[model samples]
Target chain A: MNKPASLVVLDLAILIDMYGDDSADTICPALSRFRSEASKYINQLQHAVVQQDHAEIARLTHSLKSMAGLIGACQLMEWSQLVEQAAKQRDQTMLANHLPELTTIWAALQTELASSLLLYGSADA
Target chain B: MTLTRNIHVLVVDDVILMCDFLYGVVNKVAGCRAIKALDGKAAAEYLGNERIDLLITDIEMKAPSGLELAQRVRSGMFSQTPYDIPIIIFSGNAYREVIEQSIAFDVNDFLVKPITSAGLTAKIQYHLQHKKVLKPMSHYAQLVADVDYAKAIELPTEDRAFSVAIVRELPEPKADDVDQREAASKAKEKKEKKEFLVWPEHATTGYFQLDRRMRNFAFNVSCFHNVFVENCKPVAIESERKRACEAADYLFHISKNIKQKDNRRDFWLLFQQRLDKLQPHVKELNSINIKHHSQVLVLLKRLAYWWMQTCSRPLIQINEVTHETADE
Candidate 1:
């Protein structure tokens, strides 16, 4: 897997760290939200990969890569690019090892995001 | 007057991310609400239903570029159609072609992009203030002896905001030739009408001295404001250097007289009351000035902390600017 550029797809890592969710606790909710969104896209990406749809995989991975940068998701930020590179080269071995770990981090991020959203939802409402 | 309450801002950009960023920033401004459009075509569709007070559209886009949108907007051929709307083209390029296009399309203004939140807000404030001045010129029709030129500037068909160009009072000659031999009344109108003559803000900085050379009083004040921005501070002026300096020099003389008589209290009182508000040069710069030392300002802490936080980052760095430009 080729190492991806830090900010090609998901930019604004700087801005999110600076400004996203100024009202939330540490702006981690934004980070969590990014993780959940990536999970949904990556889930679709897995389906595309199994069906040999490289184009869809590229598009989904590219978007998730960008989103990772936006939310400053460190591991996914690194891994999403590798996923994109593996998909590009049709390296199923590299893609398979990274997908489960990416999915796991993404799941943990969703639970955290949902909990944070619930907390803010009541507080803001 | 403008519906000085919430002026609806329509932010058009091709990038979804940029559009969302502007919407957040605009919504935070007092007396403003924002809607987003992903591209110029999306903007045209949104305009059909929305009565937007201002349009902040980006220049580069996938379809119906911002300039094309501005042209269609000026022509009144688009769908929530109003008579004339204020538009600011947000481009990375604010060069000759973009500026001339804005002028030909009758855009209220132009701003260069990659601007920070503060820079973006400044242009917004300027156009909005320009609209305010013109919109109320109607009620001052009494000043026009009730020959309402209100329609000349225009009232937005839906809301009452006036177009910025009409709001900016043009300095046309009062039917008098530039001769010392002009009739008494004609000469008097010239004295009162001096400031309207001005170098367009887009003019090259080189042409600035020409206004001073001509001794055009109102144009001089405009020049003074621009000069301060260019030179970085107020300059010491010579007595009777040019006709433009006449009104200001006379005031300076009066101020000197007050100083010689030990009237510091009265002089500063007059300064706050009658001077800077009317003077082209204003001392109160940047609701967000970082170079000065003051405790009352918000956002200073954030700026102060940026250096400490970003010191370890590989690609970014922050530093304080020692010199400051004057507010134009």
Candidate 2:
């Protein structure tokens, strides 16, 4: 996988700052875990959207938004918040329109996380 | 004040990643150990058995939410730990209702989520230094009732809106008034002191059996006091009261065997009398009713104080013996 010239999906400087110099060891495993959990939440979110389960959508998106924001996945976090708000307001039209865009950002985030994990020598990855 | 033992922080959230993240952040702090609980139930289990100095939890979770956990802790539902343990509730959204609920639950602090390490570190360190002052159980119960009532009654949007009308405006304080306020504040500060109910070190009598019985008596009395204050079930109150009475009776019996100086004998006699007074309350509690609860609580409080005084008697005697020897 080719690394982006400038990484946009995941900014890990916050994690570095939080964990200090030896953050690579910690960040790698967390990134791996995040990738796995975020995928599961995103998949559940898609199913919730298909079934028009507004409450489930809101819950999944809320969890995603929190997880994204914690790791500084700014784009994914913003999209998750928008989707969460739409779900809360029972806005099916908005949800239908934004679901694809949210998935795209999630895919990019996963790719970025995968590459970063490899860079950090994550054994699980 | 620096804690002598490692600070144990119980972090609870439904999200695994979030829980792990918090666990990592907590462990980064020196002398701090973090235990993660995936949900409120797990957290309660840890609280029951472990020595948790602090609690950081997410508000929204399946059954027994963070607010509910806080309620349980404040209500003395967890018998193994102090009810006034500091609780910090964190969530992604700090909605008005959530904030209101947190306040009603008497949470020590609330954090808007996406919590950074630095922010969490500051909160943990601050709470570690300062202990939470718990409000009365009735106060929390009333607050919860009010919150529930407010939620149940939803007025029309037009009627929901209201403006505060100030009936009067107070004048600013004069210079002398400011001086008086400052003096009063200092006087209040000087008056405040930490009360020790049972100082274990000083409470140790030379007789190991007596000391053990004294400790058991103190523990039972404390358990009863807590259960009564929280207004727990009658069965719980009865159980604690029974244990307390048995411990007190044993303590009083054993204390009769110890030989004391004439001056010290009076103190022991007084202690035994206090224990004797508690017997009627224990009997009354056998047919316990609401009316007797307050009276019983008051008597137990006094008994606990007297118990502490009696525990220090041995130390006092030791000091007197040293003084007499020095004079010789």
Interface RMSD of each: 17.0, 21.0
Scored by TM against the true chain B, the candidates give 0.41, 0.44
Cα lDDT tens digits for candidate 1, B1-328: 3336878898987545456567777787778899889878888887777777788898756557787676666656555756267787765322333455555456776654333455567668777777521233223223223344322322122122111110111233454564643665575555433322332222211112322322344345434333433344423211112333465455445544444544323213322222332233212222323233352122222221221111111110012111112222
- Model 2: per-residue Cα lDDT over B1-328, one tens digit each: 4456688889998889899888988887777899999988999999889878788999877767887788777767776767778898887654444555566667888775556787688888888788767788767656545766556422112122111100101232354677797886675444322221342433333345566676677677677777877889978887887887788777767666553422333233334544554566555544555458665754654454344223322112122221111100
RMSD of each: 21.9, 26.4
> What is the C-alpha local distance difference test score of candidate 1?
0.48
The alpha-carbon lDDT assigned to residue B82 of candidate 2 equals 73
lDDT of 1 at B134: 26
Error of 1 at A39 (Å): 12
Q: Which stretches of candidate 1 lie over 4 Å from their true place?
A: A1-125, B1-3, B93-96, B132-328
Deviation in Å, model 2, residue A3 alpha carbon: 23
What TM-score does structure 1 among the candidates reach?
0.36
TM-score of 2: 0.57
* Residue B293, candidate 2: C-alpha displacement in angstroms: 72
The residue ranges of model 2 lying beyond 4 angstroms of the native Cα positions read: A1-7, A18-22, B145-328
Of the candidates shown, which would achieve the greatest lDDT relative to the real structure? 2
